[model samples]
Target: MPSLPATLLAFLSILSLVFGGKVLVFPLDGSHWVNMKVLIEELHTRGHNVTVLRASNSWYIKKESPFYTSITVYNSGGIEKELFEEFSRNILVIRRQKRSFWTKLKLVSEVGAVFEEMHRNQLNLMGNIFENKDLMDSLQTAKYDLLLTDPAVGGGFFLAYRLGLPLVLNVRWTMHGEAHFEIAPSPLSYIPVPGLELTDKMTFVQRVQNILVYMFSKFQKARTVSKHYRSFCEKYFGSEINYKAILQDADIWLMRNDFTFEFPRPTMPNIVYMGGFQCKPSKPLPDDLEEFVKSSGDHGLIVMSLGTLFTHLPEDITEEIAAAFAGLPQKIIWRHTGPRPVNIGDNTLLVDWLPQNDLLGHAKTKVFITHGGTNGIQEAIYHGVPILGLPLVFDQPDNLSRMKVRGTAKLLDIAELNRTMFLEALKEVLYNPSYKENIQRLSKVHHDQPMKPLDRAMFWIEFVMRNKGASHLRTQSFRMSWIEYHSIDVILTLLMILVLFCVLIYSIVKCICLKVVLKKKVKTQ
Candidate 1:
């Protein structure tokens, strides 16, 4: 006969399987996949069955994994590597130009066009999926407990709605703008919008500028991105279905940020902050890397990386950076993939990739040189490392601006970068003790939470699965019209009523006064 403990263990395993939920993940590729994979691995560990929907030409998402089964859809042309590369090249060239009103206007227009094309491609893919009867039937028959996705792309929102599944978002942004602006109450008077690079406490002029930028972004979004999704919704769904409203109706938002990194702002109950969820303590470095770190001795190390997309700068810029690194006392580990710079320093070690989070956590690490991606910024904060930021494009400058305001980072304009400027900026971050103290304070606050960010995210995901939906947590404000939500209609109605009451009182008094005046005149005669 089998041992009692062995039999009990087997029975418990089966029970866990019975209770496990099915999660259908519609994910964005590239760095977004990096964090989504972390969440998928944790869900797998907890006995959930995860199925990922990926594009046929995906850059980062793998076809097979033990954690989840992937469903590859035929992607025509949307969010490909070449597209981003071209965009990056264009942005760099524009940024290198002298700053002017035209330069800024051109940059904004380029960004709007690029995002519009990306979203259009995503919508086309979703349309194909909907048109394919066999695929649609299989997806429907799977009986998934809920759909989890990153709202940076809109396909997930459409898919969840079509399947009638509770939607959960792995989000810092949506198709229109920041997730909070779409779902939560954002007062622009305090909550600075993205791209403006303003802090919470702004001067009167800055606040006025903030409102203007917010309005401009809305206008740009309406002109460029909204029409495509509007048509897509009308074709598949009824004309009455509002795509933006669907985003607001999502069951849970696993926001990839928290107050430690973000300025304090009004937020919603369903928007759960999971910043640094993917960050963990350092592990032992590979043998060669460890040997290099040991060679640095007491001077510590400077780690440099420009996120996933832009691996290297232009040749001259790279040479300038390499020359600057040569002058530093600290050993350097830089993630560079370009042709070796002739001015490359003996103290610098160049690699195609590095263990980013693990390296940031190392005790010998003194400063981080980054492109200011959210993931990299959070990891730096988690490790209490100060930053020398070279913000390239998109939200990089904005994100670095926040870090600069917090006194834990210094931002350098890549457009005006030279060896001397780069060297001075690096020295400033390294020699400054206040930068270290400020980042460590943030790290302490980030670590002092009741539960780890990953765990909190898991609880909400499972909670949605157990209940089939988190409707109670979701506010119905999305269903309200713009005029109703802002109470503009109510205010106008109250003003009209007051006006009518005043008119009536004035007419009655005038009639009584005239009658009394006529009677007095007749008696005198």
Candidate 2:
């Protein structure tokens, strides 16, 4: 009786041990880890044991963390810090050139080459993992409840299959293209392909352009990215298991986008939209930063960050942006890692990093100047901050395009950026009340969801764990051949039957006419 409380605590611990599942995560590195870490923490809070697989040279994923135990895989060659930095430098250079069809093509080619190399690197790492008998044995013996991964790379897919674990994808992109296109039905007519920067409402010409771009994407996937993965699959998983099928076999896709940020498109039962899941109410800023922000008086502060990968723009570009900021009455907080710009003003604060979500949620924060990464866009939407966008690389332009179409943002070309243009764009966003009202409206809709995005995601993850897999919700379309999936073979059969019927009818009519002509001849003789 004296130790009743202690006894209850022990029982609760036992209960949690019995009920909590063991999740093995093979996550993508860099900004993707930010999203995955959120889920890992949530799972840990719910008493689940998490083990993360990380490359030894990973930029972001830490070997030590309070929430999850990390298993460091040595000699794994994936996208390294140097590769991204080099690629970013190339992109900046290419974008600074005169805009033309050839220039745009060069930019596209540069991106394709970089991604292809990344995929190849990931495949090599996956092969190493497969060859490691000790690692394989350890993974097999651990008896993981499920495999949670980002499908941007193919390693997790192969590992999950090898370990016979139920797979759940924390995905927005696969190796080939958008995750939805990989599993769900994406009509080119209505669902604009990524990188096209076209909206769902497309004119006839735009649709044609969409189809051409879609074909090019498919060709690139088949020729470069998918070929490597397919070869790896055949070598390891056997000839019978298609790499595409392995990608589509995921139990669930925890999409990092919601309708608020994405255009309306066909989705799947297993596709869970968890956009802005990582966002929350802003905490109080540091006293110094708060004081600086307050110094603006009635003029609110503007927060600017170009996301993680491209923290600092070219020197000339930064100078132009800094000069533009200097002219503004509102104070500026910019996250820049490079050398200080010469035109820096007293009102501007340059920091290596800032609490982006916290600043966006600040009531006095009026405008968000960004490179339009998905995470930044979602945060701005959650906090209802209008955007003055300078999209740099990858999907940044496309992301900003979506916001521009929604009238919540204005896009500026990085190549043509100058002090005057930058200033004008900032003024438009600041003075144009419509931008603020629209973003606020979207924010309201985002907040009015039935369940919080993160909670919903956690529920689905646990749901898959309890059910072993959500195969019931997964579509079998991936198993079908292209001909079968599109009903082309069936259509051809139907066409053949119709042709035979018509030919039979024609023959019968011809024989009847010939017989009638012979009878008339016989009667004449």
lDDT of 2 by residue, 1-525 (tens): 659999998888788678999999998888889999999999998889999988888888999999999998885565678878988999999988888989888998898888888888878877888899999999999999999999886679888988999999999888877888888899999899888789999999999999998998888778878888878999997898888887788899999998988999888999999999999999999998999999988999999999888899989888999998999899999999999999999999999999999899998999999998989999999999999998877888889999999999999988888999899989999999999999999999999989999999999999999999998998888888889999999999999999999999999999999999999999999
Candidate 2 residue 521 Cα shift, in angstroms, is 6.5
Model 1 lowest lDDT segment of ten? 75-84
lDDT of predicted model 2: 0.90
**Each candidate's lDDT (Cα)?**
0.92, 0.90
**Model 1: per-residue Cα lDDT over 1-525, one tens digit each:** 989999998888788688899999999887889989999999998789999998898888999999999988898787678879888889889888877879888899888888898899889889988998999999999999999999886889899999999999999988888888997889889999898889999999999999999999999888998999999999999899988888788999999999998899888899899999999999999999999998999999999999887898899999999999999889999999999999998999999999999999999999999999999999999999999998877888889999999999998888799999999988989998999999999899999999999999999999999998899998888788889998999999999999999999999999999999999999999
Top candidate, metric lDDT: 1
Clashing pairs in 1: none
Q: Which runs of model 2 end up more than 4 angstroms from their true locations?
A: 1-17, 76-78, 510-525
